[model samples]
Target: MLENIREKSQGVTAKVILGLVILTFAFAGIGSYTNSVDTSVAQVNDMKITQSDFDKAYQNQRNRMAQQFGEMFDTLSADANYMANFRSSVLENLINEKLIDFATAELAIRVSDERIKQTIREMPEFQVDGKFDNNRYLALINQAGFYQTSDFRDYLRVEMTRRQLNQALIASEFSLPYEEAQLTGLQNQKRDIRFAQISAEQFKASVEVTEQDINDYYQNNQNRFQNQEKVKVNYIALSVDDIADKVEVTAADLEQYYQQNIAKYQQNEQKRFSHILIEIGDDEAAAKAQITDILTKANSGEDFAVLAEEFSADTFSGENGGDLEWIEPGVMDDAFDEAAFALSSVGSISDVVQTDFGFHIIKLTELKPEQIKDFAEVKDEIQQLVSTQKAEDKFFELQQEMARLSFEFPDSLEDAAGAVGGKVQTSDWLTRFGNTAPFDNAKVLDAAFSDIVVKERLNSDIIEVNDSLALVLRTNEYQAANTKPLAEVSEQIKTMLIAEKATEKAQNIAQELLTAFKAGEDVTAQLAAVNASFEVKNDIARFGAELDNNIAKEAFKLPHPVEGTLSASTVTMNNGDLALLEVSAVKEGEPATNSNFAQQHSQQLAQATYKSFIDALRDQAKITRREVVQSSEQF
Candidate 1:
């Protein structure tokens, strides 16, 4: 029965189930199927975490960080402290996952194979045109480095089981009604406020700066006005694009390359099939019986598309008259793939197929045979490919020769360029932070400015700008760092001093107003004495947008006003102005009774409880970390 089911299942779905089942049992503490036992990184209870697993996980994490950080990723990755911290984090997470897996096994937590099937079917990555395409699913899994469908399925199964256990734990948490109400009220509280601004511009005209202040500032901060070191270089560049036109591809080469890579020219056979699926959940027997009856009707000459439209449970395809479009082998569950492919010809009806998705009645509607393009049809494409290959080979050969010639004659790039049949290039003077091409590369800039290249007048070693491109440079001119004379920057310093004095004057005036207001003196009357107009705002919620956002944020931070009294505070706006805020009334928000609020509150509470549960599990587990293993360069 199991063999029959396997034979009728879709290839992708079958492999998914197989992989997940393997992972499920592996995590359930079945130790008999261990891949490696000798080289363990850490041990949780009796289960050993292998060195291979740690290396793979660490490499994957580093790749992700490199992609996210771009050029800076290399700098961080090379830091000993950062790499140490990252390794520790990866190990801790691995330990935590193992503990969770152990807990699930102890509590008998299990995820059904049917659930795994549904997840794979619904994954957007595997879908084309809003429906699961078996060919697309197979292609993605293969491209992702999963040689066997079972391997990818194993990963998914482990994740699903962990999620199932976590959800079960979350469901056990409960939040009290009073607690929810209090949180709701706090989140929605509002304040009624009034404020007056103390503008820096009001005092700017009164502030003054002397020549003495400018001279003093320039004298004390000489380092701030220095010229950066600069260098100009004579270099030789070797790139694939430069060599492409010179590298010739003959007709014989194109034919030979096409014959060598024949598989690349062939298309996979495909078939179009319609199916009516009876999804199996808890009541598998009932679902099976329903699918059996449907198959009987289908074999009895009933219109399959009509039956599928009326009875299929796959909502994505059922509405389209059960049309799955074109499918290739290994794209679907193994059973389904086998049964569909085994059908003798177009318009043939398949047997009732059983897979993780449940049962299906399949009818093959169209068959597309595989085809390979002849040399004549793909000659241009083959010629381009051969040319690129030849150009890349020439570039590497010239790069090596340039490196050797540059080292042999350290004084000039003339020898290197002549030896490699390339031209010598020169750049204008560029500073350390130069944004020009070639000098923009950090490695090239560092090498160009180094003492060996600049002072010793030696040719720098060949630097790889990227794959298929390299550079060798010698510094032709150099500029040493020097401080600028104070006279050149004295005016700039005088303007900065004036702005500083104006801001200080404004802050001092605002402080006096705050102190007077706290001492029962009327701040509004005081502002009127200075001919300043105060702005008044009302009914400001914690998140209100109309008021100056800085003032609103500070107003919310202040303590609520006492009964029949106001709370006063000062806030500095972004534009160098200060505001003296007088919050006259505080209104407590009413607790929300809406369904959205309740649902969100429940989710937050459950997450908190789940975290606590995981923490408890960690604290209770007997975790043993092996001796620290230094990260290998291989990763």
Candidate 2:
């Protein structure tokens, strides 16, 4: 099962949906990570997943993971094995997409131009006050990493076609009563077990770590104990923090600012609504029947978003689960506006409303009333804004002046600092792999290490850290990269060797105990001789959280005991702890009869059906791979 692969991997359908979502958030300034060489990394039939495509997709996935993990991401990515798996999984997702392309093409699935245009129109991001805005659409596509609207349209065409194919497979899935019962039994299975932890920490104190072991380990792994290249620099810093305090805004200034930006203080009443549109096609009755079924589902407390995405003819809004975002009067068709605005409360649905286009079942998701802030109500905010603007203006002026001085006097930042009424400050040691403090930005590190600043012994140009801060730097001192002295790392090596030896000891003991238990020997007596006891857990469910995660996973993974004999095995843990697992009893749950169980079963089967089809396509596809460079970036 692909479930055994990337943790119940949602498969290529999920990958495409994720790509579509990230495309919306792909701001203009996000740096491109693709290579200049246009080579195929993977191919399906005549179609190729180019290096550029792979790089862009990988960057998107990497960004998602980084956002999810935050500070812990640095530690996870530092592991070469972990990163290698991550890169491979990302490439596999792309390869799966290529296979989908071939399958969809072979099946004659294609998204029409009208569908594409409608989808674009329904997109809430491209709309202003609920009406589709062409200018907003153009600006957003550029921000979403597309230089041309046609390019985005082409990309959307492929994915939407794939979505059509995916939807067909999902809609065709059904779980029979017997299938649901069978799955419920397995899902709710329980195990009664007793396990003894053969912890490595118990053996660590007894494990002998000799001087020779430390020396040998240290000699073989010197790369692990190297002092990375480092540098300290003298820099002239200019920031809004330095300038904003010196600026002042009077009470009259606040009033004038409030009056100048009065539009910003006014908020019009708006409501968020979603609609399922059924166009008046050739068979009007069939269209009405389809919409009636959808309306029934929506009224019965079914997820309106899911219903919208599945059935709405308005492709643009359907893509966002039928959401048109916030809208007031007159933005949409007169009929739609009248029906939607008449809803007095949130989560209320309007009756069928007819327009030239078709019929709509509108759901009022949210409503916000109008607001106006008087001068006194927002005086503090206005003061801060005025001060910030003044500081920004001053920051730009000083940045230009400092840049001119730094270039004219390349040898030192002292003159530049004097010009800006600031002093030259020294940085902590910054390494090639890890930077320190305010100099941690990539641009700052690049400028600090550039040939002009380091080798030529000249000041760097003004590097903008952000909108509020900029700096000019020159190298003060440099240290050559070298291995750390043996004296400094000897104890570290000794500790490592001890841990390794201790793990070995734990494994041996766990294995010996497993043999005794399986052979019906008196292992409990043997274990009691040592200061350890097996913890007993009775009737443990498959996903019970009370047990340790590592142990619980293994407990369910163990095969059932047979012929009145316990199933015994030695399990090695992630933390180098070993466990002697003995399962004494097993129970299969009674067949479930609940409606929720059947519904859950159907959803699971649907996803499985879709993934199985994709996997089959992938297996039959002529896929190829090429060696490409991997990024060596660190957080």
Candidate 3:
């Protein structure tokens, strides 16, 4: 899902980014590129993944990588390397996305505005501490390069469409037992091995080292010292959160605002509706007869659910006793929606109403009265609005004071402290690229390397590193280029010794256990003594499982479990846990009975159809052509 989001965000064009989709591409030239427009980077059915889309995706990818890796990434690759890799990855992803979109359009998958609102509300990035933060939410969208909510909503729409279509496709693409077996059979394979390890300590004695060697290595890596220009800018900012506490809104004002926007407080009428629907065939006469029969039964005051079961074609709703939940306007077919809403009281039944779905006889089960909430009932909302404004005003006042003091006394950090009454946090020397001491944010580190701090030895500007706070800095002194002597790092060498020894001990134990197992010794006793449970994940299928590592793939490649220990293997998990497994039992996919077969076949067929529909679109879209430059620069 994260990868899917990455792909969609990548394909966002300059126009699309600024085109009103919030949180997409930025209007500023964050990572723009110039290329010819041939309209053939990818094809989705009849649609195109235009050059603009690829460039945007590529640009966003680069920005994200730069933000993530920072200085460390500078030495990893050149511009060409980045571009080549980005092109291949983005092209494949965009192709898949466009295909799914085409399928979704054909299928007419839709998402409700309520659902989008809910998604936004649930996003953790938009939250502060533990509650939703509107300021944080807005800031993130702006940083992402989107201009407004509507644009983000459109991006969300495309995303939902892709998901729904993929789901539908998965349901349609039924894989038979034979196909499932072809994948699952691989998991039945097994192998045999005996292995051992050599630790880093083992090679420590053989390692060559000298004082000159250290000096040479350090001198050769001057690019590491080629400092990037970082700056701290003095600025004044206004935000609602800062002055919110200072603003005092009166009850009279709140009342007036409520009166002006009464619709916000007014309770909308809701309908508890039930309908007996008679589905129509293409033949008008047949539909009319079905509608007529339902209307007659309803008029006779027959139990609605009973009449629905006897005459309605909406099997799903009919089985539920013809109950439809409370609905507002615009929720149902226009004809049915109008008739349902027109009801003035409970127990009222509508005349047979014609719609695209044929005819519906609606019963008004209940009516909710409209009411305007009093000011006291919504005081908290008003308080939040007024307080937020006050907070913004107060925050910017402090910011302006800080900026002014910093400009007047450029070399003194305390000048700003006196002006804004904000505490001045000074620290010892910090590295140019590395974040340590007082600098923990990007803005702080950037300021440490600026011309004013390094050359002129002056204080920084009011730097808003993030949304909530801003800071100013003055470099007290400079540290010349130097490396710590080996004598000072001797204790560090001892710590490395302990780490290498522990790893060697673990590997030695593993090897000894593997040997014992080969001799038919009980392995459980050894593991039990170590307090580790030996897990045997049994009869695992190859596909449709959420396993990202090569382990699952390697597991399938092994032959069916035998009485012997399998290959001596080592996999270092992300968290540093390593595992060695012996295959004990294995099973493969096989055909089921007719009833099960039918159900599975139907599901797979649906999914495949959906996937095919999407793939066709991607294969035909208006994509631009270019020699995909494989480089990390295109990130």
Candidate 4:
């Protein structure tokens, strides 16, 4: 699935930053300059996926994994083996994106700025107390590394384009009765099976192991005994904490800083304002100069909205005479905010304030009075600033001493530890290929098995798995993979068989019920007589149309649910069961009362239509992705 949100990952900061960059690229920003020119990774239509593109995507995915898994991140870095897998995934995604782009262009479908704006306005992320907050939205984008809402909206445009492309492909595709009937029988099936489950614990008393058996098992699986290659690295970590401890805040310093910016900490009845954006590109010095001329007109008393329409690059807001909904303090660039708020009354235009976007002439559309959020409220922030400066100095000093000691006792774990006065700890036994405690990091695990650790029986070189930390490892012992004897595994096999049988029986019963119904029998009555319960919930529709499963959706789509057999439809249960459904009734979804609900349903319907389109295209398309296995390791 193309997830709408970046799933929480181990290294969130890196992933989020990369995500923003990716967004930037889609908006025709500096990201394109960073694109890979290599031609081996992906084939998008006639275009090849460049190595740089693959690397960017790979880095994003790797960082996401680390963030999601946190300290227990088990995946190896861009090792030779992992790189191969990364390349394959990146190629596939690139190919898919390219295909969609081509199809969208061919269809002449374009996502307009208005659509992007509407989408942004509807996003729940920008809401405060269930209403869209202009300031909050801007703050979020800034924190996520966006320079402007324009860049973010451009990303939404690409997504919308892809979605529309998919919908166009699937519009004519519909499931027929034959398909529906098959699906219905699978869903309505019942299982009435009685079985005994004998687990491993049940036969524990009857099992016994001998040393010979253990040796034989280990000998048979010799490949599992071999260790994977690993590296040990040494490095230093620089963090905010390392520099925040030594800084000291003096009373006079705090008071002076506090007095200088007392207004910053003061809460106020902030006015809401927004502006139409006119962005100047990095290379468009000439265009920017032209923009300055337009700002001059606004400063000369011309209506800001009128001038925005004449020259603003923001097509969406410009159409509305450059009306930017509502905004609050902290919603704009520092210079722009300062000028806008400095105005004494609404409708007053301020002199030009230069920001990266271009020259801006601020119009104080509204104003609110001050409330108390005094400098004392933010005294801690000032204190931390002073403390951070001191900490930074101390950290640098400590690092210099640590570096000296590390160089003097290179490859000497005990000597280095003693020199630094830090404790030296030993890790539990870890295999190069095992995922047991304290050895999940493949690189670190490999280092423990290297010649330095194994032959010399010494601490391996300091290994850095991630940017923030480093470690040295010494292997204590090795354990090989061995299969349990058949006697020990028999109970496990039996339990699995029982579940499989039950599932199989249920499918058979479901098929029988559907068949009987088609033959004019009361299938529900038959079920009851057999002590098998059947549910006949009504008014189920497709997603967005209604909230229901595939079976329910199919039922609601049927033409004659009150009498004739329903068109069989497919339904996949949560327990991994695929069933055929026969519609019992047809009830269209109710009319939504709230705007939010209406929008939600609209989006869902659009997404469903889009997915159907893509599926159809896939069926008619011939695609071949080269399989590159750099190593035996599987993701």
Candidate 5:
């Protein structure tokens, strides 16, 4: 069954799957390990899976579900049975990853350092303008919580090794010609079908929906017609941007701010240089001789750019005359930076300078000296900075005051707004599924309908609308959830009850027609008596979309009829209409000769084979689970 499903999932590589897993867990801080918590959740062979790992994985899964389901995610997250099943699935995936890691290590599967470096260089996150940027690469690693480049490289190496192992296993799978032929036939099989719909509308006139029936239905299903709880709120919002224009800064403040944030204003010195390199791979003496010969040519007044373009081994920069373009301090290797920066004048060349990459003959071409802008020159920029800082400070202070005043008053936002020198804003009637401006915010809606604010009529705690904006709201007008009066909903209930009865009648008529059709009796007269007509769709494939989907599905499920006979069944559609279906002829598909069919068949077989192999590996492994503590808190 697993193999059959895999057969349909073509072009899904193991690397793509692992990449998705990494992305899913990235939000849970999967790559960041905490040494403080050492409790084990599970052990695969000698490696122990930590409780922290399980917690992180589970939280990542929850975050994904929350993003997918939005408000409904809260309901599912609170369901104990759903949570139990979710935890089990998370732990199982973690264990499987561990098992794969252990098996790869046991088999000594390895990836080359060059492969790992290439992978990192090609990553879009670490690139700028389609070229690899060293600074961006370092920044991204740090942002992803990796303190060292080697740690990220090690993670990449593990992922690459796992992908290599999976590819090897999948490549070992093959399919027989007969199996491919059979699957091709099955994919193209066709059947000739005829169907007639007995619409609910046909029986609507006969359905008796009395006032008593309507009243009974409305009474029995009052809960379905009840209005959602609603509230109108008065809120005070504070934003940094709104307060920024009101702040003022003087000359002294500008000077003080400039001094405090000198690093942000200071520019780093830059240098432009070109070099001719001789890479020392195995024989250092040979490389030294080669660099000396190049240095002699350079000193003898030969063009440095010409020499670099011909003799430099740094291919990335060599093509551009070894132009390591304009580089700031700390951008290059330490030894290289120092040697190049030591040259004081343009056109000055260094003789046989040595670093990790090679021996280099360096020439300084241009320089830009570092400068700090004077307070008077940057006064406008300083004023903007000071104003933003002051506004943020004031916003925080006012936010705290608003929270305090709202809490003390309990029933109104008037005191809170007055304390902050802001105005109280009122919203329209807002339901759990609210509409309109402020009510559209999920946090605002959740707080508006919460028990403390809606039922007890108290001001909500400060709800953050964004990083710079927050609000405190209180319910001004509240409406309790209640069912509509029966009289108000009786007509709607009457229409619905009539539709239900009509559908029941249509289904019975369809079943009777189907029975008569199979019994070799003509049903044309019967259909005419009910004011129904037959519609025919011919040459429908097993997966064809020509006929109504429900009818097509039921027709294919019926066995092929004997010659000159028919197979009939009754099918119900989404609109409560009944379809009386008859299969007149069945045709087995011939194996397709198209290249697309060949490729699809090949992929399906490979996937099926890979799935079977993995299942076998899982079956052979000895697995165990310890008592897991499921917590509601996000890790």
Candidate 6:
């Protein structure tokens, strides 16, 4: 029952609020956000959201949608209006973040440094053997992109403050006794609904759009018919692979390279071992004492594996009988390496050893002697590596030379192409939106239309398309934005008008049928005329699992029927069809205040209360959005 609450809270707005108020992106640290120069895209009161900040958030959301939906995400991008809404939503999230921060400050919500430290210490990810391990904590945050622990602490402090503010607002909300009873009854109520759908398609055969109607509609919405600016260009696409293809390594060169990196061809002696590690935290004495006890047990033949499993701080190896299999001498700590290699006897236990990590008691299991592969065995692999290295070296040299030559010549890409051992290639007309890549690359597209390329007519400075590829382009043709002639788009306009008329007619017919049903008039003839019949559903809960989404949404908007009166309404379905619904019978489910549904709903109420608070903050704040953000909404 409560799962629906989770489902309801996963929308874009809820997710963004959750992300800003909490670190929901990862276990810790926000996504990588950085800027060299501050250029505000928006401002919430005194708080500014820079272009870098907006780009980071927008790109993060875009990437998340792409990941969640895969190819289906492209459908969202395909619609101009949908894309605009998506961009606006991301901007709104940034605004919400600043607004939330502002509210937190006004409320004087503060998280103490000691409390932040305690929170970090209590996190299970940073703990080893039920105790906080600073090394583990540092490694984890660093891996999560918080290179400095202080930065992670600051982030944690801010999130804690926002959470505190929101929580306080939520806790302040209270439903009175009568209000609670009313809400419980309403929430538990079920409805018996009968709906008749009038398909917009059925009326399309009779719909007509006169030429004059089409012409007038087209004249009024001409901006929608205008074309976007486009450009055709001459470009040199240079890639590391092209240079790699030209790199040649002789047999003698491969032989010399192999000898220089001979250690890579030689396999080091491997040791298999078991160990009991006791992590040294603030209480190093306790860790040392524990290791000593475990060491004594192992030497005394009291089940070494059992001792390791129970006492080891390295939980990963501890679970596997402390086995660290077939590791080279230098694979771990320098002290660990020395202790393991010094043991010559198989099945021999070593004394308690001290290292930077902690104390460890080692039991040598087995060893593999060193071996070297024949030159013939690795010749092919060595040749490929040598060739790649040479190609990379040459590519770097040529990349810089190409950039210099492109700028030096300024007007043409031929010199740059020649310098990089590449050829100038022509491109199909690229829209400002970039119909294809390398034109699709943001930097390439930006330069492709910048005044130097489109107006002054100079070769673009070398732009890296990706890690491997670089590009220099010169405009060959430019298409000025223009509106399509009415003659060309008349049919398209006519079809759209016909569809709109048909939908409106369908809605009117649905309303008439609804009126007839309410007046207790015979509607069998009307139903037959439109080829529609009532669909009855019983015991439909608030979850609306048994009903269509749009139909359910419309059905529930009706006020409860009382004194033998019926509740009726009409809604336009997603497909331009209309659903006329009437609730004939209502039954209330048994209310259990302690149920999961009730608890989840209480949380929902709390969120709703918090939302009101944020809304108030938003209304009171001075919000400003710059042009860079506005122009992006069009795409």
Count clashing pairs, candidate 5: 0
The TM-scores of all predictions, comma-separated, are: 0.64, 0.62, 0.51, 0.49, 0.68, 0.61
Candidate 3 lDDT over 1-635, as tens digits, reads: 32243346546574476566443335534344333435556655466666668778876765677689985444332333654565687787777776566656767788987577557767898766765555566669888777786788788878877777566557545556665455434434332321222233433454445556545544564444344334332323333454454467777766676677778777677668788887667787787777777777777887877787677777765786777756656446678878988888887888888897777888888787877888888878866765665466567777888787776666566767766645565464455444442354546666666766667666666777555566677666665555555555544554554555555565666667667766777777776554444554554556535442445555555566555445434443333334444545555444333555556656767856865665666456655445653222222
Instruction: Sort the predicted structures by lDDT, highest score first.
Output: 2, 1, 6, 5, 3, 4
Q: Across residues 145-262, which tens digit of lDDT does each residue of candidate 6 receive?
A: 7997778988899889988887787777655555556677877878788888888998888988888999899999999999888898998887888888899999998999888888
Better of 2 and 6 by lDDT: 2
Q: Per-residue lDDT of 1-635 in model 2, one digit per residue for the tens? A: 22143333447876888887688558532345344445777777777877677778877887898799986775576465887788788888988888888788789998876678678888999988877766577778899888877799898999899899888988887778888888888888888999887778877888898888888888889899988777889998899988999998788888888888998788767688999999988988988888888888889999999989988888878999899876656456789899999997999998888887898999999888878888788888888999999899999999999998887777788888999999999998887544444665657888888878888778888898878889999999988789999899988888888898999988888888888788878787767754567999998988866877777788888888899576878787767788888787889887776788877777898999988998888777787777644632322
Tell me, by TM-score, which candidate is best. Answer: 5
Pairs with backbone N, CA or C atoms under 3 Å apart (clashes), candidate 6: none
Flag regions of model 5 displaced more than 4 Å.
1-191, 209-226, 248-267, 271-387, 433-446, 449-451, 480-493, 540-546, 555-564, 586-635
Residue 460 in candidate 2, Cα distance off native in Å: 3.4
lDDT of 5 by residue, 131-215 (tens): 6666678878898778888899898888888788778876766656677678878777888877777788977888898888987
Clash count per candidate: 21, 1, 86, 36, 0, 0
TM-score of 3: 0.51
Q: Score each candidate by Cα lDDT.
A: 0.81, 0.81, 0.61, 0.56, 0.79, 0.79
lDDT per residue as tens, model 1, 345-381? 8888887889877899888888878899988999999
TM-score of 6: 0.61
Q: Identify the candidate with maximal lDDT.
A: 2
What is residue 466's positional error in candidate 6, in angstroms? Answer: 1.4
How many angstroms is residue 51 displaced in model 4 relative to the true structure, after the best TM-score fit? 5.3
Q: What does the lDDT read for residue 220 in candidate 1?
A: 88
